[model samples]
Target: MAAPRSVEPADLSPLAWRLLRVAADYEQRTVEREIDDILQAHISMLENGSRALSPSRCNTLFALYSAELTEEQIRAIAENF
Candidate 1:
């Protein structure tokens, strides 16, 4: 499965971008949440770098974007978070 890539925000880590993209997709498709607004909030939280994906949320995100990333990749990314 090919992953989504962003050219901008060169400072943003690959994992950060993928995690946020998956979160946004979940928010829009599964939860019926207000995606654009909530996505902004998620982005803000991640940009600070002090915050990391909690265990539960990380699992949920892995399930949602499973095609784009693997459990190993998720764990590797979470280690840096």
Candidate 2:
């Protein structure tokens, strides 16, 4: 049987860590109960690697953070891994 791969902090791309941090911050600041739940789910995806900061997901994250990011920047972040 193969051993599970170890995920080190250094193994995560800068963009992945950035997305995870921002999502965590948003979860902390959000006042809306329903949206907070959704944010938690997004955080789970990022931490578990089930989902990544793809262009579409990046757009959603940026919107959640109320931060503006260009498509090119988004693409760079998405493809960093």
Candidate 3:
């Protein structure tokens, strides 16, 4: 089976795990420098959940991946951290 491209809230490393997948997907889709800035850390660290995303950065991600996601959804995602 293919690995999921988004993390579940109940996962052990919810924020980091979901951010990693979202970041990778964003990277693949665009050459935006902002995305580069967030993933400055090595991919290994990101994949392993050693790194977590900040709220401002999450705003950038939300803008890119799921612009239609509501503020309530964003808040819910934040609560996962």
Candidate 4:
């Protein structure tokens, strides 16, 4: 196996660029929600121990953000959880 090389945004197809942006945005939103949830007592930091979102929740958030992404992309993003 080899290390992946970094590429400029100009190197990506329009769709790929869009997907990348969406994924990054999703991550930011999820992290923000987790922080808010912890402060509001909606989730317990001591018990849960981790701030990661579940796969189903990721799917829901992705859906809320965009309908353009394929199912494979959605699943791939959710699997990060």
Candidate 5:
């Protein structure tokens, strides 16, 4: 099989963007801290400690955002990550 394509913040769908915004808001509220930049926070999380999003983190993020994402989109996320 060919190598998976990279998933950039720009490549994300509007639903993906909404998921990031919600996740950022959820973290800020639960942690009692503000995320000055939601998009940056998401990028950091996706790139956490590596050039790519770790599988575990990707699964976790997918689960967290699954409520707002379609299965096809989640599958796309899996493929990208």
Candidate 6:
């Protein structure tokens, strides 16, 4: 199996989590199924100290989540340290 994504507790802010939750809700998706993937990817990026979210990926995620967030908001979450 591939290595698990590393994550730091502090790297994820409540606001970001809330946004993610809202996104999941908008899609009528369970957190376990959809939102978790994005959260895990973010956690991995945070732990690795890598800024690796591409616009295409963000768009795909937003579409999956049915999130109404703007590109700036998504970028902010991904760029947050």
The CA lDDT of each predicted structure is 0.45, 0.46, 0.46, 0.37, 0.44, 0.45
List candidate 3 stretches off by more than 4 Å: 1-25, 28-36, 40-47, 68-81
**lDDT string, candidate 6, 17-62, tens digits:** 4465464454223432554445564634533446444545444544
**Better structure of 4 and 6 per TM-score:** 6
**Number of backbone-clashing residue pairs for each candidate, in the order shown:** 0, 0, 0, 0, 0, 0
The C-alpha stretches of model 6 lying farther than 4 A from their native spots are: 1-18, 26-39, 43-52, 67-81
lDDT of 4 by residue, 1-81 (tens): 111223322233334433543554644445446443323221232114344345454334334443444455544443433
What tens digits encode model 2's per-residue C-alpha lDDT throughout 1-81?
111123233345545545644543545235234243345556566656676645555444445443344444434444565
Higher-scoring candidate on TM-score, 1 or 3: 3
Candidate 1 lDDT, tens digit per residue, 1-81?
433332223334645645645643544334225322334445445545645555455344434454555545544454554
lDDT-superior candidate, 5 or 6: 6
Model 5 C-alpha lDDT per residue in residues 10-65, reported as the tens digit of each score: 34544553455364345424322332223444544444432344455444444445
Model 2, residue pairs in steric clash = none
What is candidate 4's CA lDDT for residue 33?
A: 67
**CA shift of 75, model 1, Å:** 11
lDDT of 5 at 18: 42
Runs of candidate 2 exceeding 4 Å displacement:
1-36, 39-42, 50-67
TM-score of each: 0.34, 0.35, 0.35, 0.25, 0.32, 0.32
Clashing pairs in 4: none
What TM-score quantifies how close candidate 5 is to the native fold? 0.32
lDDT of 3 by residue, 1-81 (tens): 222235332342544445544644644225245475654353335445676566565445545544434444444454565
Model 5 lDDT at residue 64: 46
